[model samples]
Target: MGDETTHIEQAGPTELRDPLVRTEIKRAAVWIGMTLAVLAVIVLAQPLLLILGGLVFASILDGGTRLLGRVLPIGRGWRLAIVTLAAVAFIVGTIWLAGVQLSGQAAAFSATVTAQANSMLAWAGTHGFTPGEVQMDQIGQQLMGGLGRLTSAVSSALGAITSLFMIMIIGLFIAVEPRLYERGVAWMLPLRSRDRFYRTTSRMGYTLRRLMAGRLIGMAVEGVGTWFLLWLGGVPMAALLGLLTGILAFLPNIGAIISGVLIILVGFSAGVDAGLWAIAVYVIVQMVDGYLIVPYVARKTVDLAPALVLGAQLLFGALFGILGLALADPIIAMAKAALQQNADERSGGKAAAEP
Candidate 1:
């Protein structure tokens, strides 16, 4: 041998292992494979797995309430109960109000369609269009055909309900489980990175609370303001539509666009005047959410660019439909946080050595 010999070091600060060294490669491989396997299983069982996925965030939510209660000067449980009950009441009330509006508007729309069939056919004919009868006949057939598939999809939806219940149970368990997941994660992390994972998991509950608070507040503000605008415009079903818009708005950019499109379509169906009002309602709400509500409410929430958020929505939506669309933001935020934390650790070490 020459004057020196090489020594193996542990993996890079952020990666599973150092590619240049071989000592821990098998360990890293096993871990990586295991993680991928679990993800594959999740993807395969997504309809069922979705609920479990939700539990991850719910744990964050309920976890936050506990923290808030702790920080408050009074009994912790009392504060949490009051806040939770208020949230439940608000949701129930919004649903009830919107349901009433939906029934009224839906009934009116159905009647209008039946009574105006001949007139609509005549209008289509004058516009150099195919006869309205042919179009309606085709559409009616498609809708009826779709009913079967929709009914079949209901099974997945029922599974969804079960999933939601599962998430709730899992979340409650996680919130009280003495950070078992955290300890497990820490065990796998490199010696140097161990402390950070533990610390992050300790605060995971708080992170969830903060995220939920921002999300709920932003949504609430957007929802109320939107309903007021729709109501003022004398838009049909404004209350119900606003609630739908608000709920969908939870998903950020893509959600807003979807709700806007639906509002516009519904508006058009209501006639030119209603259509115009609906468009205005959507535009005003977007402005409010984009400029005022989102900026103010999400101030401390993850500061993701709208474009990035939308991109994630597109990618996730393609793979997982509405569920992915709903979760894209927080999932992306969590990823961003993890990356930044790793980068900071590396940079800090480099900077310390430079001086």
Candidate 2:
């Protein structure tokens, strides 16, 4: 009985020694590892996203620092400090100057939007829409509830000041000595992979820098242009609209839609002429951005498809909320750069191996 038990144990190892059995075991291990990885990602999604946000913020700061370096001819640290301080000063000054105006306008803007929405619903009802009063009430309630949930979730995840502070600190540290972190990450990888990893990362960084530069330029142009044109046309809440437009411009398709809707609603609240002017301003601004800014930027950076970016934005927004929405483009651009680098490497290797 003892010998039989020993034989059975030995048989297992003997089977494992066979090439086919070994391959099967390896496959099973891979599957198990992948499943575990997925589970871990699900559990740690928030922390992972925050880290990614930090990286994105770091990239923006790094980009500015590099740009400043060209003209300033100063140390990177000093340049970075100047850039950071300038950003802080701008925010503080803006708030100090227009805090009260913005606060009042924000409240009025909310009321105007609500009134316009009700007006539209009434107009639709007059056109003989089929929905009953109960259904309409339920829809309105559901929409408000959904918005409440979304806002609450975003606030909790962001933790407002705390999350912002953490992200800024993380960004500052990484920006201060990015190479240290890079090397640290590379050290954890297999020796053979370090070179490829470095190469891929280099590509990703270059793409990100270029992409962010274009986006910054686009935001500035759209924001400033919209503000000036709307103000010239005597549009109400020009400053608020401009600020919102500029911030939203950071987001792409959805941002434009949202800002445009706000502009139109506010414009109509004033008068028909104001509304028409608002429409004209929106059209002109979008045209400039879409035709001139976007094409130029696409040429310099990764030429992402609109559909692909929108799809990613939706997916990331659903999974990770507003932060994810903000980050979707950068993440996609980096991923594309990495994939391209990998494909190039594979092609080069194949070419080298051919007779």
Candidate 3:
């Protein structure tokens, strides 16, 4: 036993642990660290995701450009141009349509409110409640105060627009040079390790792309369905409601609830019967979305527990405002996938015990 112990000691740490083992340990540690960093990035670099999203969008545009570029195949030089043109067309079209519709709706809404206010004032006058220009001036002051809020809202909206523009610029750059980035990253890694690193990143990118595409399609369907239904029912603010429904669909369960509340509010304002009918429509639509739409569209999407998603949202919301809320689902989904992978690895790991 003493001889064996001496021999073992003499063999030293190098024999006890292979260099590859050490390398793999280092790799795994780094991999885990990178995973954590990604989570941190999601939390911290959310604004960047908008840029990333834009870049992803640009990359999609690049695909189309590449198709045409092949004959005379322009380099990615035309990428930014193509993306910018497409974006301009989309934005201009959306704005033109939205502006016309919103303006007409807003005018009608304002007129209705004005008529109501005038009727109330006249009734008060007939009731011998004579509050004259002084009351009108007080009301006007209140209106002016609300206008101040609009100024802030406009400023906020402008900031959002600027942020989106920056995102698009950043996205265009990233999309154009995605391979450059991969090559750069791989260059730093050892030859054998390079393939693994590239594979990991490629996997992530492919998965995210597929997931986002599916999610966007699902949202579009939900939006179209909701809008058509609301319009059929002659619901007030059908256009706005449809937009809201589509946007909210990305959020899952909470989105349905939010849409329902909006429908109820619109219904209530329209009158008791309209409101009841509207609520019925929203509930039915929600049921269809939950049971039918989610099962098929989100089929390959994250299959997480409802409780977990909701809990994550609450937990994230408490730490950060809306950014955390926005990230909660994606974050949770990634975590769940990681955990499942780890479990599988452990189950398949080399062991002394026989199965």
Q: Relative to the true structure, how large is the alpha-carbon lDDT of every model?
A: 0.62, 0.81, 0.61
Model 2, CA-based lDDT: 0.81
Candidate with top TM-score is 2
| RMSD, one per candidate, in order | 9.2, 4.9, 11.7
Over 1-355, each residue of candidate 2 has an lDDT whose tens digit, in order, gives 3455433444455586778789888999999999999999867766777788788778888989998988999899999999888766765565554566698888888788777766766777777773533333556677445432333335663474465666777888888999999999999999999988888888888788788888888899988999999999999989888988988998989889889988898888899999999999999999999999999988877899999999898887776667777889999999998888888898885111100
**What is the C-alpha lDDT profile of model 1 across 1-355, one tens digit per residue?**
5789789876565564556445467778899999998898655645553554555545554645665766677764565565556544665576566556477866775555444454565678779686434444566666445332222222474765565555655655554444575677688889987866654443434444566666776677667776787678766666666777778767787667767766665566668887798788778778866787677655654567888988887776555555565677777766765555556566763111100
Worst-scoring 10-residue span by lDDT in model 2: 144-153
Off by over 4 Å in 3: 1-88, 95-100, 103-155, 187-193, 318-320, 334-355
How high a TM-score does candidate 1 get? 0.68
Between candidates 1 and 3, name the one with more favorable TM-score.
Answer: 1
Say which candidate scores most in lDDT: 2
Pull out the clashing pairs in model 3. 55-171, 69-73
Candidate 2 regions exceeding 4 Å error are 1-10, 13-25, 91-100, 133-153, 156-158, 349-355
Off by over 4 Å in 1: 1-72, 88-157, 176-181, 184-192, 202-208, 349-355
TM-score of 3: 0.60
Model 3 agreement with the true structure over 26-58: per-residue lDDT tens digits: 899999999999898656554544554464565
Cα lDDT, model 2, residue 214: 88
Deviation in angstroms for 279 in model 1? 2.1
- Lowest summed lDDT across 10 adjacent residues in model 3 is found at 146-155
